[model samples]
Structure formats: C-alpha cells, structure tokens
Target: MSEPTRRPPSGAATLRADKTAAIAEAVLDELAEHGYGRLSMEAVAKRAGVGKSALYRRWPSKQRMVIAVVSEPTVALADPPDTGSLRGDVLAALHAVADWLTHPRFSRILPDLIAEAQRDDELRRALALRIGEPRRARMIGVLDRAVERGELPPDLDRELALDLLGGLVYWRVSARGAALEPGYFERAADMALRALDARPRRA
Candidate 1:
C-alpha cells in the first residue's frame, strides 16, 4: 500500500521548495549553455531568480553545486537491473548508459565537463569521486551477478570489464559525435561479452 501523506507544507515552506527547484533547473541550464569553466554564479542566480546568497547557502562553491546536481540523477539512471542472463544484463546496461549519455541536456553537459576536468585537477577529482565511482559500482554489481551465475569466468578482470561496458557507447556518443542506430546496443554488448570470455548460455 502507498504511504499516506503527513501534514502539508505551509505557504512559506511551499514557496521555498519551489524556489529551490527553480534554482536546480537554472544550474543545469547554466551548465549546459556555458561550460564549467565559463559558468558563473551570477548567471545561475539571475536565471534562478534568486540572489547569489541562496546558491551559496545550498553549496559553498560552483564546483560543489555542479557535482551534486549532476551526480544525483546520473548515479540513479546508470543502475542496471538484474535481467537473469549475461547478455540481457549487459545489453540492458549498455542501453541505460546510451540513454544517459545521449540525453539532450546531459549529452552537452558531460562532454563540456570532461574537457574542463582535463585542465582542472580539483574538478577531475570531484567528478571521479561523486559521479564516476558510484556508476561504476552499480556496473560492478552486474558483473558480480554474472560471475556467481556462471555466465562469466570466475577470474574476470573487473576493471577492464567496467571499461568495456561503457567505452563503446561513450566513445560514439561523446568522442565521435556518432549517432546510435537500432541494434547498436546488442553489438556493443556482444563485444563486451566476448572481451570478458563469457560462457554461452541457452536462450
């Protein structure tokens, strides 16, 4: 059964909640329109219709704000469900990753961040910790499941496996500016399975 609602928010509280949502939207817009290096607190503040202090209250710095906002949805979206087969699991994961990397806003934001991170050591560390690590951990869950179910070799080099999972799609979507066609996910999945020397299973 669904949980019942508690006391509703007061008028002032509702206004605050709405304002915060607006601010988050503004941050993503600012990030997408302007790369991290060029994104400014003033721009986000004006776009959000809130003073810069409001942003400061939420995050101490622009880097923290960008990482927190981008990381939350990213980590959630990349989680691959257990699909009961190595091919199915890998295919599902690749499709999820492709969707995320190709989403209109994210498609732009990520490449921009990647370029900016190359020159900014602080951002590089934050992106790896807050975004990259969490998503990789979820992909590891998929690998561990396959190993236990005897679909993949017991001694799978998991780091390489993780790289294989996203590399193809990420390269096409971000590096080459290539579009993914129908059945591309399957091809990528097959390649990853072959790379890891996965055992064949009955359909």
Candidate 2:
C-alpha cells in the first residue's frame, strides 16, 4: 500500500516555507549571474530581501543552499508514443534532451554546476542524488524498454549506456566549449544502440 500523506503544517510554518522558496529562487538567479563558487550569501539575502541570518537559519552554508536550489523536480521524462518501435522512442527522448540542453537558460547552469562538482564533495553528492540520478534513471528506463522490445541486447549495462549518452553531451557542453549542437543526440543514440547490439557472446 502507498504511504499516507502527511498533514500540512500550520500557517506560520507555511509562511516560512514560502519565504524559503523565495530565497532559493533568489539564490538560483545569483548563481546564474555569478556562478557557484562566487555565489554570495549576503547578496542572495539582499536580492531575496531577507537578512543573511534568515538564509543561515534555513540552510547552514552556501553548499547546503545550492543543494536546496537544485532539489526541485524540474526535470522529467517525456512519455514515448511507442510507435511500435524502440528507435522512434529513443530518438524522441534524445531530441527532447537536445532541446532541453540547447536552451540557453538551462544550459548555462550546467557547466557551472559540473565545475563546482569537481571540488565540493558535498555539492557533488547532492547534485548527483537530486539531479543526476533521476535523469539517469529516466534514460535507463528508455534503454530498458528498448531491450524488452528486442531493439537492443538484454545484457547491455544500463549505467554504461547512460554514461555514453551523457558523455556525448558533457564533452560538447563542458569540455569542448561548445553550445548544444543539432543532431548530437540522434548521433549519440545511434551509437549507443550500435554498442548495445555489439555485445560479445559470453564464453
């Protein structure tokens, strides 16, 4: 059975929650402007029209606040139309990813976040848990369905498939200093499918 829903908090608690959300939004804006390492708590407080103590009361540190900023359910998978073919679904999902990654607003934060992940272990963990894991799971689900439909090998490693797909985008966005490019996702998906089909026979 599903778990029961918890009761909503009182009016004051609700107000505090709203204030916290406002602070988080302000912090996101600041990160967009200044990037992660240079983000200032005092600046966020001023932009949020709250005192630094208020932010500190809610989140102990800048890392914690950044985690909170990204901890929302902003990313999700699009339901495949299942045109009786895995290729179409995979292509569709890839296109969706390309569109998401290419958008100037969303794409700007990624390089920053990834760079931050290199040094701050706590932020890295939180980003992987909150943002990375769910998106990876969605891609894995797409690959799993392809396997079920016999479009790809059943023994294919889902994690590796995700790495391949993500690596293609990461290389362009983070490493090559290029913006999201057209046809990149389709090419990645094609290569991923080929790899899935080319698994060597077990001894």
Among these predictions, the greatest TM-score belongs to: 1
**Model 1 per-residue lDDT tens digits across residues 1-203:** 11122221245343365666777778788888887888999999999899998778777899998887788777888878888898999888888878878787788888899899999999999999999999999888888888888888889999989887778788998899888888787788888889999996634
lDDT of 2 by residue, 33-94 (tens): 88888889989999989889888876678887776565452354333346545666666766
Determine which window of 10 residues in candidate 2 has minimal summed lDDT.
Answer: 1-10
- Model 2 spans with C-alpha error above 4 angstroms: 1-12, 16-18, 77-84, 179-185, 198-203
TM-score of each: 0.89, 0.75
Model 1: residues >4 Å from true position, as ranges?
Answer: 1-15, 201-203
Clashing pairs in 1: none
Superposition error at 116 for model 2 (Å): 1.9
The TM-score obtained by model 1 is 0.89
**lDDT, candidates in the order shown:** 0.82, 0.67
Task: Give me the displacement of residue 153 in model 1, in angstroms.
Answer: 1.2
Worst 10 residues of 1 by lDDT: 1-10
